[model samples]
Target: MEHLAELDKKHFIHPTSSIQQQQANGPKVIMEKGEGIYLTDINGSEYMDAMSSLWNVNIGHGQDELAEAAAEQMKQLAFSSAFSTFSHEPAIRLAEKIASIAPDGLNAVFFTSGGSESNDSAIKLTRHYWRIQDQPERRKIIGLKRAYHGVAAASTSATGIKEFQEMAGEMMTGFVHTETPYEKTADEAIHDLRQTIETEGPDTVAAVMAEPIQGAGGVLIPPDDYLRQVRALCDEYGILFIADEVITGFGRTGKMFGVENFSITPDLMTFAKGVTSGYLPLGGVIVSDHVHEMLKEKSKGTLFHGFTYSGHPTAAAVGLKNIEIIERDGLVENAREMGGQMLRAFEKVQSELDIVGDVRAKGLLGAVELVQDPATNKRFSPDQQAAPKVIDQLHERGMICRPVSFEGTDIICFAPPLIINREQVHTMVEKLHDAVFAVQKELQVKG
Candidate 1:
C-alpha cells in the first residue's frame, strides 16, 4: 500500500478519479497483464474485465499483434506531420480504410487525438461548415439530456449530463438540451425534440448530436426506431446530425458503428476509443458528401482546424492493424452471438433478485438497473449509495464492473470485450450474482 501511494502521489493525476477517495483509500493498482477478457493484478488476483477497461478494449487485452504493429511503425517512420503538403502512408491508408467502412455519403475524414478532441473539432467544423454555406446563424447545437459527449468546454457543452457541467460555473450559451428518446415513446421524444427546435427556432439550430445507445448515461438504449426518426427530423429541420460513437465503435455494440446497429446514417460521425482497441489514441469525424463538398469548395486554406497529432502515423498504423484483427478473427459476429447469451443470463438474475428494476443489453454492452422495489419500479434513494456498495462488493469478489453515475440511480453496466465468449459471460454473471446478494444482505441489515 505504501508503494502504491508513493507511485500515485509522484506520477499520476488521474482522470475522472475522485481525489477524496484516492486520498482515503489509495488506488487499485493493476500491474502485470491481461489476456482475452481477464486481467491479473500484481498479487495474482484475476478479475474478468467486464467493463472492457471503460468499454474500449474491444479486441481484448495484451494482444502481441498490436504491439508488433506499433513497433514496426516506430522502426520505419514513427512521426510525420500532416501539416501543409505533408502526408504519411499509414495515415492515407487509414483514411481510405475508414472511408470503406463508413456509412453512405460519409466519405471524408478529419483526425484528432481522442473522443474529446474529435468532438471539439466537430463542433468547430460544424459551425464553420454552416458559415461557409452562408448560414452562420445556425449555431445552436442540440444534445440529448443525460448524454455523455466529452469533457472539454465545447464538448461538455455538447454533452447532456449535468454532472460533467456542475463545476463549470455556467452552461454554454445557445447549447440546447432535450429529453433523450429513451425517456419516452419514439413519437413523444420526437415531439419534444421538435418543440425544443421550435422554441429555439430551427434556423438557429446547427445540429443534433447523439449516441445511438447512451453508453455512459447508464447504457440507456433507445427504441429501435429512435435513430430513424432522429435522422428524418434532422433532415426536416435541415440540421446536421452527429453521432458520437466513441464508446460504441469497433464492435462494442455488435456493429462496426453504433449508428449502423440502428440502421441510421448521420451527416457527421465522431469515433474513438475502440478504433485501435485502446492500444493507441486516435479519433476522427466522418463527414457526409454534402458537408465534405461544402467544406472543400468554400473553405480556403486548410479549414484552419486541426491538431499537431492529427492522423499520427503510429496511431493510424495501430488502427489499421486493429481493424484487420477484428475482420480476421470475426469478433463482430462473435459479439452479436455472445451478447444474446449474456442477455439471457440476465433473466436468471431478474427472476431471483427482488432489487432488479430493468435489464438492458445489446451485443457486448449491457446494464442491470437496481431499484428499491422492483415490483413498483421505485428507485433506491440516492443517498443510500447502493450502486457504489454493489461495485465495492463486486471488486472484493475479484470482478471489475462500473456503476452508471447518471440520473442518480443504481445501474451496473457490463461491457466485456467483443472477444468474450459464452463461458466468460457465465463467469461474469456468477460473480455479479454473488455480489448482488451480498449487497442485498447488507442493505437488509441496515434497514
Candidate 2:
C-alpha cells in the first residue's frame, strides 16, 4: 500500500488538487472499496461518504446491479458511434427514459460523455440555434456570478468562478456574468437581469444559463420564484433559458431535475453526475420542443457537433439500471426525508456552537458556514484556512466532506447519498459536531 501511494504521488495528476500537497503528503486516503454510504481505505479504515464522492454517487456505492448492466451491454455491443444515422438500443432507450421524466416540452436528448461536454454542447447548440434563426449577432451567453458550469472551453467561459478562468489562461469572449440572486430578493435579481439585458443589448444575447442551486459555489440556493422569473425574463428578451443541472439532476434535489423544484421550464437543460449515480460517465442536454422544432425548420445540413463517446452503450446501460434503482428503491423520497433530518441536526448544532454561523440544506445538498464570530458574522483569516482544518478533523473522525474556501468565506459542504437513512444521518451529524468542536478547541488553544 505504501509503495502504491508513492507511485500515485509520482505519476498521478489529479484535478482540482494541490500538486504541492500531493507531493508532500503522498496519498491521504487510498480507498479500496465502498458500500452504501461508507468507504473503506486500503488500511481497513472506514469513513462515511458525506460528500457522496464528489456529489455524484447518489445511489451510494458498490451496487452490483449497475455492474451487471454494464457487463450485459458489453457482451451484446460494447461501442458504437452516435453520429451519422448510427444508433444503438442502449442509447435510444436511455434517451427515451430521460425524456419521459424530464420537464414538460423537453423531450429531445443530445448525449455527451459527462457534465463538461454536456454544458459545452449546450453553449454551441444555443448559438447554432440562433444562427439558424438568421440571428447570428445573438452570440453572447449570460451566466450567474459564482456559478460553476464546467472545465471545458465553452463551459469554463460560461463559469463565473474567476479561479478556473485564471488557471485556464484566457477565456472565450461574449460570455457575461451577472450578480447572484442571493445578493438580493428574487424581484431585485429580476430587476438586475433586466438591467444587464438592457445594458448588453438583448438582441446580442443568445441564452442565459444558470444552476437552480449553485452546487460547488457553496450550495447557493436562490429564492423560490427566482427561476420562474428568470424564465420570464428570457422570454421577454427572446433569449433561451438554459438550466445547468449537472449536480442537481437525477434526484439530487429530491426531484428528477432541479428546475422541477422551481416549477419552471427551460429551453435547454444540461445534466450529469447523478444520471448514472457515478457508476459510469454519462450526461446530456435536454432540448425543449420549441427549440427542437426551430432546429428542424431552419437547419438544413447536419448538426455538425457530437462526441466520440456521446452515447457509449455500456455507460447508457448502467444509467438505465441506475435510474431504475433510484425509482424502485424510492431514493428521491429518502433524500428529502434524510435532508430534513440533516437540516434539523444542523440547526441544533448552530444553536449550540459559537463558530457555526449558518446552516442551509435543500434535499440532500447542504452547507455549514463557519465563522470566527457568529454574532458579527466575522470570517476567519485566510491564512487560518479554517475550513480545511475542520475538514481534516472530520477525516480524523471518520467522515468525508468538502471544504469550500471561496467568495471570502469558509464553509463545509455536504451531499450524502440519496439512499442514506435516518441512522446514517444521525451518525454524520454527530461526527460533524465533534469535528467542529475539535477545530474550535484547537483555535482557542492557539489564541
How big is the positional error of residue 389 in model 1, measured in Å on the Cα after superposition? Answer: 1.1
State the lDDT of candidate 1 residue by residue for 18-122, as single tens digits.
877776767766557998888898788988789988788999999999999999999999999998969999999998999888778888899999999998888
Candidate 2: RMSD to truth: 1.1
Query: Which 10-residue window in model 1 sums to the lowest lDDT?
Result: 22-31
Computed on alpha carbons, the lDDT of every model, listed in order, comes to 0.88, 0.91
Question: Cα miss at 71, model 2 (Å)?
Answer: 0.4
lDDT of 2 by residue, 307-373 (tens): 9999999999999999999999998888888889999999999998878998999899999999999
Residue 441, candidate 2: how far off, in angstroms? Answer: 2.1
